[model samples]
Target: MDAVAARSGVHRTTVYRRWGDVGGLLADVLDAASDDDWQPPDTGSLEGDLAALNQEIQTAMAAQPPIMAALIAASFRSEKAADAQQRLWEDRYARCEIVVSRAVRRGDIPPRTDARRLLIAATAPLYHQLVLLRTPHDPQLPGHAARTAVLAAAAGAFAEPEPPSADDT
Candidate 1:
């Protein structure tokens, strides 16, 4: 806290009064950092759009600093960090919904496709390899992930659940 105050040239009391604690500050920073006006580009097809998004994710992941790995790991154990991380991911998944919705409108995917699940399935492997395994980054993983997600969605792997019927109840 003192270091942050010193670096930012703000008084410690002011920082404390404003943020209350490190978690509050982290939440604010994460929220601000998560803001992006860029939407998935319309590449004329769902596959094309997904490929573009995959490339973007790969590029961004490649550029992340080493500290991000530690931060991601810590978020799992820390309540405040976990909350912020969850919010960040929620925002990301919401953004990805646009792509799926567009695909539905284009008749490329079923209207009942679960966009959030598809997006998570698409990116989880990459994140697992990067953060959990700490393995060397695979340049081809993003493309493969996107392709897998497209295939899964086409196969109804991410389809919405069927509504309950009165047969049993």
Candidate 2:
């Protein structure tokens, strides 16, 4: 709040009055940065769906590296960073979850599968490895693997082939 107030030339009290303390203010900003018009693509298959989802994350992270930097820096010392990260994940992942759930409902995915884990596996490694890690991060490393390895892990992990029947013969 102090930093923001200082930057904006507004009183800390004024900022607090509008935003309800620093965490709320940071959450709002983080939510906005994480969710800038990102919508999941439904391509009628888990592979395509995850691929599109990966691209959406890459695009967002690419556009707003500063948001990642801020969150990463804050994560070092404050609970606010964790809260901000959780909110950011919910906002960003919820869109993809809705799309994945559509697949589940349509019988493209197992009804009991864990969509959140699938998304995290498919999506997080590449985005975080690239943006949050140092070189040999290669930038290229994630893009190539993201489309195949990462997305495949997501699809396969969450996709149940079908349960064996109690009456298996």
Q: Give the alpha carbon lDDT tens digit for every residue of 1-169 in model 2.
A: 6767878998999898998755567767876778688677778776677766666555545554345555555656656766887777787777677766676677765665666777777776765675667334244443454455434544566655676467842
Model 2 clashing residue pairs (backbone): none
Best model per TM-score: 1
The residue-by-residue lDDT of candidate 1 on 1-169, one tens digit each, is 4656877899999888988876666677677868867576578867777777777766666663533444466576667877997898788778778888888788777767888888888878777777667668777887788888888888888887874456822
lDDT against the true structure, per candidate, is 0.75, 0.65
Scored against the true structure, residue 159 in model 1 reaches a CA lDDT of: 80
Cα error, candidate 2, residue 65 (Å): 6.4
Per-candidate alpha-carbon RMSD to the true structure:
4.8, 5.8
Candidate 2 deviant stretches above 4 angstroms: 1-25, 31-38, 105-107, 136-156, 159-169
